[model samples]
Target: MGKSTASIDWLHRAPPVSGLERIEAYFSGFGYDPHRHDTYAIGHTLLGVQSFHYRGRKTHSLPGTTMVLHPDEVHDGWAGSDEGFKYRMIYVEPALIQQILGGKPLPFIHNGLSNDPWLYRACQVLVQRLDCGLDPLLEQDALFDLAHALNNAAGVNTSRKTFDYQAAERAREFIHGALTRTITLDEMAEHCGRDRWALSRDFRLLFGTSPYRYLTMRRLDLVRTLLGQGHSLVDAALTAGFTDQSHMTRQFRSTYGLPPSRWVRMLGRT
Candidate 1:
């Protein structure tokens, strides 16, 4: 994908894949507000300095380093210098990671950045070809490597806790099937055959986010799809199970750091 000119902010999204969203974008100045989503944001700076406020401190990502923002962590983005910055990012759902890691705690790059060459290589395979869709087998292979690379870079977790992976997986599936309607914790627990609180705790430990966040993110995923298919905001919001347009808009901006209108505009530009 071509980089946007310094005078314009633009974003180019790749063909969609299940459990992943990839995009290449450029910004001359401020990029995003403090926002977060229920997916791991991993990528590298392709040009200039990619700056963000993560974990209560400002961090700058330069070329040749991999940036890994943990799921649901608050962060903001901007250019670190006047020249602007361009980068490609892939958001991977934690459930996909859990599929490979088998219920282990999600990896955390303490500083939200990694200089590990193995990690850089793994990230490159996913982000470098944003314009081209990956083959199913190739993508799965890369994800497996990426998951292990992340775990290795973050070091082994010495503290272990008992978690019911099967129950959490069942609950996740229940959430997916019920995205078009409201779901209660008790209901999900009954379906998954686990205690509500225990299921919630296990879900967080295994998936790196709460069950509610995962459901909301999935709904937002549907909203994006509806919007792409020319649905109006209100229509998309309602169809995605949100209470109203304003409700969806607030959640959209809070999760993505920009309003739905702006996102649509950027998509048009791309």
Candidate 2:
């Protein structure tokens, strides 16, 4: 097979987020280079064989399969066969998944792919586009279901028993409220009534990323929102807690394969 490293063609049609963005696209060929994202690339492969190599393994994504590419992992993408591959993915900061998982433990899907039915169904809500915002109660329920489902998919049911889960939930809420605000592990721990180190470990187990990373995502989510609302890039970056527009621009380009100005221009044409 010929190697081709293209860029991710993104349709940023997601609800405005500060730290992360949800993207939908149908790619039929190689769609990435040896690039890494600051966020979690979570989504379903809709059709054909979406092939990518990461962590020293060649993985193929068939239809109905969910692929979880963890943060900062080097990976590349291409079609596994002549037919090409198509997928719809959401670019979520690990923080959101962390928020959903809380201090439990980050679910690990070995080989970066899964044919899990429960996970397939949970992803439906995410794939429904931003218009289909989950109702508060429904959102919470879905998230909880997703948490357990991920745990099972990642084979993290070692305890196999009930345990206090409220801390994770509380930590998640703190992350949300402090999106534009600065939050530290110690602060989150103090608020959630847990030791800082214990809280950090649980956070990794449940969310698959670190607390600091989680906070950065929250900030990025705000950046998206501000930009979508027509704020100037510099203004949005500052309002979103980035040091400056360049800081935001670097992350935006790295994650979405384009800068904020270019992204907005593309949106105008669309």
Taken over the whole model, the C-alpha lDDT of each candidate is 0.90, 0.67
Structural similarity to truth (TM-score) of each candidate: 0.96, 0.69
- Writing each residue's lDDT as its tens digit, candidate 2 over 3-78 gives 4422333344765344344565544465555556655677877767888887998888887788878775667777
Q: How well does candidate 2 score on lDDT at residue 92?
A: 58
Worst 10 residues of 1 by lDDT: 1-10
lDDT of 1 by residue, 107-205 (tens): 999999999999999989999767577889989999999999999999988999998999999999999999988889999999989999999999998
Q: What's the TM for model 2?
A: 0.69
